[model samples]
Target: MRLTDMAPGMRLAKDVYDPNGNVLMRSGTVVTERLVKALRSWGIDEVTIEADAEDAASAMLDPKTAAEIRALLDQQFSLSNRDHPVIQALYGLCLERALGNR
Candidate 1:
């Protein structure tokens, strides 16, 4: 996709690289507006991103709505076995992705 059409919170489907072939960012890194500006300055014009079916719906949610959902998720996760590193990691990733509306 064209970098111009990208938005913050979109995940990269592939690694990005400089003209010299040095990796700029790894695959799965979330796109940010600041990163977009930097990439534009570096002459990058396109990127491959994950195709999310719910992205359009999620984008409509305001930060406040996202926060509310996060709070609910936090309450639910409190009952889980957070002592396990794997569960903690999973919850952390879920928190980041679910709260990406910010």
Candidate 2:
């Protein structure tokens, strides 16, 4: 079956072929929500789940800032210099205001 047809946790094996029908690699576990969320928290969208295609594709990536973020994440460094702090703070404020601090 095609990658698009498999369920979230299902596994499938078939002859893996490149565009020229040459074996490129073998089957492996597909990307999952946990993996995608990990990437999301890092402000990167490299690993994609079939279900998150639209959101992943439409994500607003700031080229200049994303490059910096990518470098930080790749180096296992910090993002204190980026706007994530403010963005997350605003998100928390909005949620608290909307939900009344559950």
Cα displacement (angstroms), candidate 1, residue 5, comes to: 0.6
Which parts of model 1 are misplaced by more than 4 Å? 53-102
Please provide, for model 1 over 3-96, each residue's C-alpha lDDT reduced to its tens digit, 9 standing for 90 to 100. 7667788888779999999999888999899989988988998776664713453556785786687688889888899889787656655654
TM-score of structure candidate 1: 0.51
TM-score of 2: 0.22
Best by lDDT: 1
Tell me the spans in candidate 2 whose CA falls farther than 4 Å from its real position.
28-102
Query: What is the TM-score of each predicted model, taking all chains together?
Result: 0.51, 0.22
For residues 40-76, what per-residue lDDT tens digits would candidate 2 score against the true structure?
A: 4544422212323322322345445444544544354
